[model samples]
Target chain A: MIMIILFVFLCHAVTFCQIEFVKVPMQKKRPIHLALYQIKLPLPGVVSILHRASGLLLFLTLPLLLLMLENSLHSAQTYASLVALFKHPLARLSMLGLLWALLLHLCAGLRYLAIDMHLLNNLKQARESSKAVLMASFLLMLLIGVRLW
Target chain B: MVSRVVVGAHYGLRDWLIQRVTAGVMALGCLSLAIYLALHPGLDYQGWRALFSGDAVRTFALLFMLCLYYHAWIGVRDIAMDYIKPVWLRLLIHVFVILTLIVYAIWSVQILWGY
Candidate 1:
């Protein structure tokens, strides 16, 4: 990008430079030395990606959740069976996972909506909102985790 | 040869609009639902069944389900497109997603008005 800018700059200033400026030779190379842990992704960016991941998690678990709801409302017997299933450690763990996904998605989604509506315009506001989103998700997760237990 | 007329991001405009519209509705729907559930404390099986037995709640559930499925379809479709490179595999997964959402929609209808 800098090289392209310099080329354009030199083209404008130099008399001998060809002015046919049709194609800009661009470097197709990307960041090959990208170390995931070393790079500090801004809070908003982190939240954005986590939103996508949490959404996928929710999507994958939707069928099972729908089944659970169906069975719970099926009959007294089925509801009782669901309650019994809820007692299993694995069931509880999966439920917790789903809850976290829901919380994260919901919070991040609201943040996005706020941004789209221009509720948070500046970088500082974006950072603050993202922080609030994460904090709210964590607080809700903790509250619900305790309640579920 | 098919002549391509449509150009640029406008091609995705419909999907983008559907995504936003469904997202807004679902967000509001979820908030209202949470409020309703909070008001009804210690809801038992009978309470739940009677609640959905009413037409208003059933319609609300069905409408939200539609919006949710639409929203989810776009989201999942985008994800699969991004991560799943193989064209055949991507198509298979996309078909499975569509079929599953359809089945879930039917199941939701059954649950809401099953009695």
Candidate 2:
């Protein structure tokens, strides 16, 4: 009976030591192996990230846009000057970019709202909606760009 | 099985709701502006001024501005919480952002109602 107890205790001790050793290396190796750049995100992930980017862009530009609106509405002279500024090629290009960003953001926001409503709760539907958003926004941007040019 | 209860500042639902509501408001504002712009093409000074001259439009614009600020605050705060881990640094950033947003809010009011 004493010999059997000793053997069982030894087995338990060995297994516990193995577990501790394995856990230590895993904890140590995790941060080094984690690489964000190496990961390939899916479509919905890309759309979600772009939504954040566009939101940030819009948030940052709010001041500039408000200032422009204020200046344009301030007086006839300022308004004319603003119009002339916008007529420049660089300004038009930037305006186009902003317009596209706004449209894309709006589309993505609607998709998110749908998801929040539990409309597209499944992965497949979510992916399809994200793709639809991308295509629709691109098409709208192209149409608007043609009109602008 | 053992279960653990987690305790923290629980404002997630409130923030989520606020963001959605403010987004809806902003969307409405954008739609109105788009319609106005489309109706009045080649918008010059007087035309632009006329568009905002109405009491309804001005009120909507002011509401839009307020919604924009709140929407931005929630979004930016979430971003900061995600990327900035240090407690003190995150707090400092939060302060700075709050101050800037307050300034913008005041500025927006001045612009909209300064006539």
Give the winner by DockQ: 1
For every model in order, the fraction of real contacts preserved is 0.58, 0.67
Q: Write the per-residue lDDT of candidate 1 for residues B10-110, one digit (tens) a residue.
A: 35679887888887887788788767677887888898788777888789888888898988888888887778777778878888989999988998898
lDDT tens digits, residues A10-123, model 1? 877764433323223323343376788998989999998899999888888888888887888889999989989999999998888788888889889878777778899898
Docking class of 2: medium
Per-candidate clashes, comma-separated? 0, 0
lDDT per residue, candidate 2, B62-89, as tens digits? 8888888888888888877777877778
* DockQ, candidate 1, vs. native dimer: 0.64
lDDT (tens digit, per residue) of candidate 2 on A17-54:
99998898888787664588898899999998988898
Enumerate residue pairs that collide in model 1: none
lDDT of 1 at B113: 75
